[model samples]
Target: MLNNRYEILEQLGRGGFGETFLAIDTRMPSRRKCVIKQLKPDDTTNTAPTPGWFEKRFQREAAILEELGQNNRQIPQLYDYFSEGENFFLVQEWIEGITLSQKHQQEGNLSEAQVEKILRELLPVLDYIHGRGIIHRDIKPDNIILRASDGKPVLIDFGIFKEVNNINGGNKTVPLGTPGYMASEQAAGHPVPSSDLYSLGLTAIFLLTGKTPQALTSDPNTGEILWRKDAPHRPSNLAAVIDRAVRFHPRDRFTSAQEMLTGLPGSAGREKTSVVVPPDTKILPPSRFERWFWVIFIVITGGFSFGFGHPIIKPWLDYLFPNEPTVKELPLIEPSSQINSFVLDEDGQTLVGGDEKGNIYLWEVATGKQKKTIAGQGKAILEIAISNDQQILASSSEDGTIKVWDLKTGKERITLPNQRGLIALALSSDGNTLVTGGKDTTVKLWNLSTGNLIETLPVEKEVVSLAINQDASIIVSGHSGGDISFWQKQGSNPYEPRIFPSINPWTAPSVAVSADGTTAASSSCQENIRIWKDSDWKDSPLQAGSSADICLIVISEDGKIIAGRSSDETIRLWNLNTKKEIFSYSPSSPKSFDSPRMIALSGDGRTVASNFDKKIQVWRPSF
Candidate 1:
């Protein structure tokens, strides 16, 4: 619009103090596309202009961007920077690619290889910046783009240039970066180089969870991120590295980007892809702004220590004084000797539950009183599947054994041993066929009455979720690789089993097959409920709804309702056709406690049951 040399195409987004746009720089004959950002100064402040300070800060930031672009291929090149009236504008290369945020939505939560690849690509960029005494105050998924042409990452938006920020004596109050990705020190405006690492770690977490850090729930007191349980594919090695990177205190985090990169698992004895830092390298000493942060830190620390001070404070005073309190007391979830998995029978009269200590409880559904209790096979019950008639209960244990308990007698009828990995159990309606799937990549069928081996199912992948039709004729099995196998009872191979592809296999750890065999509903780490229509699993879904914490899922007999237990101790019911949550049941929990592991829907789909740590409740849906 200014001088007719540039054309505004579309508004990209708005930040705290600026607006971003996509524009074509017609100044060049080729009319190349570029990004234009308008930085507006606060008009409300009446402080006298510090003669040329703003201009000097603007020029310095522009020069820094140019320098970074020249040295690093992953950074966006600066094209032009000019001021129109009180507002400033920056013109830069338009990255023809998707931001990591967009890529995450297009793809699933990043796989481990993707996370490692990201760490490998961007850590060096951080090393380059931190070496020059500049911290990329904003480093979230949105600011990092995956260039389509070369498949490389590009870091953008220096955000309030390091010098321009009023880090001196805490004058700048505007929050920097996106909320979830901002480090504690950055929020306090006393960021060190490590603060960037903290933001990077949070970005990695976002990729893994397909969720912003803000959506994740943290422990009330300790403030530790309770992310592991929700993100299904966190490998311990990578998780440990990320854990240290995002430690609450900057001092407790990796000192430099180089250290964090080198500390990764495969960096040992390898050629350095990332820039290397010198030994004993130290950042420039804290400025006037940092003294304020230190005073704040000391006061907060002293307050807490003295609040519980005296005898407990005296013993640790010497050590705490010498070092920051880096040790975080990650709160422990107090274990209640209670129900771990439960299921409601078709009649809704019998409520059977399996506890962490391998005990079975038969409760009167109407009165909520325990009718019988039997000690199980000395292992935690991972899942419980009830027979259609409410006569038999199948309890899958941590040790790969299925204990079949008689509902009437509360006696162990049979203990079916599986010497493989984790197992999922499902009992058929006629009380005849039993299906057992294991991580060992085997699905076996048994005669429920005698617990004898029937026929082995031909499933080539590690089964994650399993469900059976009422008469044991149709079984739907979801595998670790997002492919589903359907088994139909007949022929020499009998149940003709065929694999059907679905959402990223890692996500569909919870699946439910309608009793009538018309529909199958599945949920994954992506937090969306996918309904696959009768044997034809394709790109288009019947209906997809946003959801989470789907550790256990089940579909109604008519395939009209879908329900699941999420991580937040809630059981939600969804109308399959409308893709709406019909109703939900959530229970308030203590600061630290166990959560439900299993949830189930009855054969008629009229009842739902969930384990409440120490108790199990069966409910009739209001919707």
Candidate 2:
């Protein structure tokens, strides 16, 4: 080599900042294979601000690598870093492995479980760097090496690589990371700990989709890459975690690497007792939404029968619905037996019913006779949602799976296997995304057409109830935390949740969003109802004052009216603008209300559907 202490064997690779060669230390008693890097483009007295910033920066990176290599096996050891004439050189341990990019090319797209295992392994490596007050700045598939002997990933090309290429090109020092892998903030000369997270998330997406970051489409307005629509079948849980990490804004990303790790599929709902995560180890636990998600699942499955409507769910239920509906009852259309869940088309013309025996029925509202029946289900169906065009019907059951059916042929289109079993779900207004809450205590967004997981929203609670706005711009969820929270979609920002006001901590709240997406309403177990438009309260809170607890809330598409039920075995209605009660229905009174498992409001805000036990009930309630 240059100094004669090493002998160059072959040229391995070359890049803008330097060239790498395979070499052996001839001076050593036992010759060992090592890597020799030749760094170039020296401008000691010219453009660089630090004057000799390149040399000093190179030395600093060597020290950092040396420390990391000694402590962690995933990093290559730095044996030497020196300057020869105008060129810089670093002799380091040669890692015999395949680059992730190479592996991706050889193996094609990896399975969700395979991608997840990579995340669980490499996130800790990033954590170790970030905790030491250093930012890797660049992370992509090409920069990671999969050791052939162990199959463990080894991180390469750290500090010095960034310092050479990341000049902000301004009066300030901005480090430019590789295109496609760069975080929005890093490009602006402000790289935070979350910056690396963005790159890492993008890398995982590339490995799973086999598409480079540039090939993915990004929303022109938010500048956030729309990878979910492209890789529709990727696991929803992992997608959700990646969505948070790669937000357009750094502040919206995970504050740290360890935080991102806890939200992935394997750790989201796991108990700490089962897996030991050391406090000093620097990895944080799951996000608040994730914890709330599990709690919701536990409370709904372990404590109540009909999810949001069960009176025993929270302390507030014990005192709610203090007085029975005082108005005359509305007209009733009844079903033959107890029904678990049902939906009414936009015109309230068609009724789709789900039963305990795993059968589905489509009935003509005018005739009250079953027009078509789709049979042979495996378990009791818990919830049902119809697409806006009335072309598809999605249903969830006790079997831990979700099925999408074509209305025209009454044939199944897609089947999603969810091991946690689904408890609550809603179809997006556009009918493309299906939002669901599962027994695993996770909230997920699915692409209906391809059965792809669009996002895994870790709400930290199981679902008491879930709702997404008509435009699919916002998601509001009621959790086992005994309150409803609002989640807004921002351009690549971390999901920040705000608590819905006018409710006590011990009350169980049921949330619903208007079809226009302009308004939302919540009916708490305390019999207290509040209305909201956008982010603020629109009207004074209304009370159902049921002689029993109020279980659920459903808002009309027009955002003008709402329908809810009480444990007093009655269905009640109210006008949002008038702030007054519309009417109440006691058609099946004297018989406990436990027979109706679910209820729905028509788009025109005039009709309501209730599944009484097994019988389907469609009624028109007048103000």
User: lDDT at 377 for candidate 1?
Assistant: 69
Give the total clashing residue pairs for model 2: 38
How many residue pairs collide in each prediction? 7, 38
lDDT of 2 by residue, 379-414 (tens): 888888886557778888887778899876889999
**Largest TM-score belongs to which candidate?**
2
TM-score of each: 0.44, 0.45
Candidate 1, residue 329: Cα displacement in angstroms equals 29
Model 2 Cα displacement at 328 (Å)? 13
Q: Deviation in angstroms for 116 in model 1? A: 0.4
Error of 2 at 201 (Å): 72
Candidate 2's C-alpha runs over 4 A off are: 1-337, 491-494, 501-507, 535-540, 543-548, 587-589, 612-614
Per-residue error (Å), model 1, residue 446: 99
- lDDT of every model, 2 decimals: 0.67, 0.67
